[model samples]
Target: MSLLEVSDLRTYFYTEGGIVQAVDGVDFSVNAGETLGIVGESGAGKSVTVRSLLGLIDPPGTVVDGTITFDGQDLHSLTESELRREIRGSEISFVFQDPMSALNPVYTVGSQIAEVVEHHTDRTATEAWDRAVELLDDVGIPDAAVRADQYPHEFSGGMRQRVLIAMALSCNPKLIIADEPTTALDVTIQAQILDLFEEIQDRYNTGLIYVTHDLGVVREVCDRVAVMYLGEVVERGRYEDLFNDPKHPYTQMLMRSVVTPDRPVSSLDPIEGAMPSAVDPPSGCRFRTRCPVAIDDCSTIEPPDYAVTSDHAAACLLYDDDFAGDPPVLHERTTGGGRDE
Candidate 1:
């Protein structure tokens, strides 16, 4: 069984204008020691899904429907204090995008990491301090003994991220939710951080939810991937399967935009059109407005998820049986005229 399961979770914000669906009817599960990558354009609700899982969404934003169960316990049903005591940073830890902001300006890195260990575990202060240094070393921070005494402002962006990772690992949590953990780092630092994550997961046998807009990072670190669009999971499968045979138009367009060394720069095809606002997303398929192959029905009725293989599923009309005639051949349609009526 999976360690965490999110089913049809809807997180929305009630603004004066209308309800903004941040995370709409999303579903996925992460097995023990598995790394699940969530990839999409900005405003796709990747971060919202993770935030909602931890009950971190503010008052204006509410988890409207569905269940977020961690290890068979319903997270949405847990009491506020109970959740804080038992779940957050105890069973699950989050390493946010901005490490500089995540750490306190005045507290020593060792004090922060030590506090996490002391809070979650039955360890003495001296023992926790020793463990904190070990975690610093584990995350590849140099001079761990002395550096642990330094403040957040004393470290570089990459080092601060590493410190946050160390703090996250202090609890020995079952799951780690890393939200663009290497966002501000250079390529070399990005590689090193990713390597550290892999090593830690291997060492601890913990599940991971890696949320990012970077396709290259997803391909590199994730065992499986779920592509999100406008709060829904548009496509999901093994990393290799989705990358090799992407069925969703949105996923295909994203792949086209990626500029790899092997692919000529001229071959890169950027997907046009901007991501629609969550407050009033386009009807039917949320991606319809931006999809090059969007058909008339795509704007009227939502498509059912079609299984491409046992492990792969995509939410698109091209695979729907109810749609009349042969599935619209995308290769023949550029202006949406080749669709079967």
Candidate 2:
């Protein structure tokens, strides 16, 4: 069974300007021990989607529709307080983008981690502190016992991230939601963090949802991927498949824009234009205005998820038989990892 399943999830913010449809009709699931990457440009609603799963959206924003099911239980039915007391740390945990901000400077690293442990489990104060040190050790922190007593500022960026990871694992959550966890670190540190994530997942068999816009990170870590555009998933498939044979034009453009070993920087095709405002996104297919191959009907009709394979699909009309005059030739992912016409 899937560890977490989100269907038709919609989260909107009530503002004087208009309702910002941050996450509109999004659907994806993560199975136990599997890693799913949600990739998109800024404003694609990746963070909001994950936040909604944990009932973390506060005032001015709310989950308007759909269900969030984790471990076969409907999370939407729980009250915010109930979610915090029961689910947030025990069954699911979050590793936010900025570790420095997430940590409280006034508290020692061990105290912060121990606080979470004490809240979720029946461990005593002394035991919780012990567990915090052990967790820090588990996440590769050197001299974890000594580091645990140090304040957040004492640790470097990468070390602080490790502390956050340790805290996330404190309660042995079934799933972990990491939002751009390594975005701020140097490339070497980023690589190490990615390796650490894979290592931790393997050790615990924990389901993972990694939210990132980095194609390189997606390629390295994700088993399956969902490509978001203007608040909707435009394409999804196995990482290698999506990376090479991107079915949706948006996905294709994203692939073309990234730097690869074979594709030189000059030859790379950067996607044009910024993402449209979510409050007033384009009609019908949200990506139509930016899609290079958009047809006339694309403006009038929103395409459904067209199956390219049993496990791969794209929400683009170009893949549908009636929409395209001729049966469109599906792009093949060449063995060399280049976009072959």
Candidate 2 at residue 19, lDDT? 92
* TM, every model: 0.94, 0.95
lDDT values, one for every candidate:
0.87, 0.89
Residues 1-341, model 2: lDDT tens digits: 68888889999999998999999998888899999999999889999999999999987999999898899899999998899888998889999989998999999999999999998889999999999999999999999999999999999999999999999999999999999999999999999998999999999999999999998888888999999998899888888788767788888878877777776689767788888898998988999888767789889898889998977999988877876464333333334753232
Per-residue lDDT tens digits for candidate 1, residues 1-341, read 78999999999999887899999999998998999999998889999999999889897899998898899999999887988999999899999999978898999999999998998889999999999999999999999999999999999988999999998888889999999998789988998999889899999999999999988788678988999999899999888777666788888777656555555579767778789999988999899988877778999988778999977899999788767665433322123211021
Task: Give the CA lDDT, 0 to 100, for residue 208 in model 2.
Answer: 95
Give the local distance difference test score of model 2.
0.89
Task: Name the runs in model 1 displaced over 4 angstroms.
Answer: 264-266, 324-341
